[model samples]
Target chain A: TQLLEQSPQFLSIQEGENLTVYCNSSSVFSSLQWYRQEPGEGPVLLVTVVTGGEVKKLKRLTFQFGDARKDSSLHITAAQTGDTGLYLCAGAKNTDKLIFGTGTRLQVFP
Target chain B: DAGITQSPRHKVTETGTPVTLRCHQTENHRYMYWYRQDPGHGLRLIHYSYGVKDTDKGEVSDGYSVSRSKTEDFLLTLESATSSQTSVYFCAISDMGQGKAYGYTFGSGTRLTVV
Candidate 1:
């Protein structure tokens, strides 16, 4: 079983559409990070949330860390073709190592 | 994958043969990690290092072994390759010095196929 479970394993949306992807876990984390990965490339760091109940916005994307630090959500507005990729969430607990979620594959059609 | 480098971007090996993947970093990060990415499984940790000569197993560390002899190099080896072990491997580096805010920088990844 994956420590971090991501919802909507596969997502297909049209350009300009909006959607939210969720990462959930029963265990709390000290730090959580979001990443976007393109085909034939490694994952690129998107954002990191350490404080509980913290929210951050990156251009058209919004990320929120759950109050319990066991969940997180990423919402993208006005999705574009460039936003298409595999999204992964990783959580760090007491150690320096990170546990990654199952990942969500997003396809935004223009 | 700017600061980190993974060698042999692609490789094909026969079952039962031993294979080794290399991860070299110039950033001097204190931590190095190895992960395998598979469909439906995302990326699963194979092993990781906290410092030179210090390593530990990860979620899916079976059939794999790691060694970190220096701060900039972490190596992952598959003792006996199997078709089930065929997957894309990624190397990641991390350092915890930015006021507790932490994130990982990953290598471009190595595509390994076991025939």
Candidate 2:
């Protein structure tokens, strides 16, 4: 079975600080997706990267797919309280299943 | 935020008791998935349905069973509740064809505790 691992499982920073979360795996995937989940709620999709070395930006968040499709990263610039949540990365092959990373919980204090 | 909804937002059951969780969606999406979320484990798929009455097991289907008799409803059943099964369950939907790049829309989730 394929597995995805995320680094810095928990993070806390002051508002305006920058932070980066990493997701890695030994198996290559066709695409990778990022999701943010608030307390007591299901996760919400943040972005999807399909091609190797592809980068997508959504407001203050930047997501990048690895050149080998075996890893990904999410970076937050000038983080705010709204940016605090659990961030998850999922790797998908050609099938319907997606392997999700452990997750990174971020807390941005104002 | 999709039209997906899960019933019994929270439930408590005893060991050896049977329990079922319901997931309902109004988007008419062709695919629905059931997943369990734990503290260290982000989300693990337990089962999924591609269409009405078409279902398949996922990575963590050991003690779980699923039935999809209709397009909008997917049911997950645990024959006998176990303490290890206590976790938050989420239902998700996607409309993309196979091999397509798309994200899933997830329901709020159900928190179950087995004692």
lDDT values for all models: 0.92, 0.92
User: DockQ for each of the predicted structures, in order?
Assistant: 0.56, 0.68
Chain B superposition TM-score per model: 0.95, 0.95
* Highest DockQ against the true fold, candidate: 2
Model 1, span A1-110: residue lDDT tens: 77899999999999999999999999998888999999999999999999999999999999999999999999999999999999999998867778899999999999
Write model 2 residue lDDT over B34-111, tens digit each, in one string: 999998777999999989998999889999999999999999999999999999999999887442488888999999
Q: What is the interface RMSD of candidate 2, in Å?
A: 1.6
Q: Which regions of candidate 1 are displaced past 4 Å?
A: B97-100
- TM-score winner among the candidates? 2
Give the C-alpha miss distance for residue B96 in model 1, angstroms: 2.0
Q: Scoring only the second chain, what is candidate 1's TM-score?
A: 0.95
Task: Give the worst 10-residue stretch by lDDT in candidate 1 chain B.
Answer: B94-103
Q: Is the docking of candidate 2 incorrect, acceptable, medium or high quality?
A: medium
lDDT of 2 at A5: 89
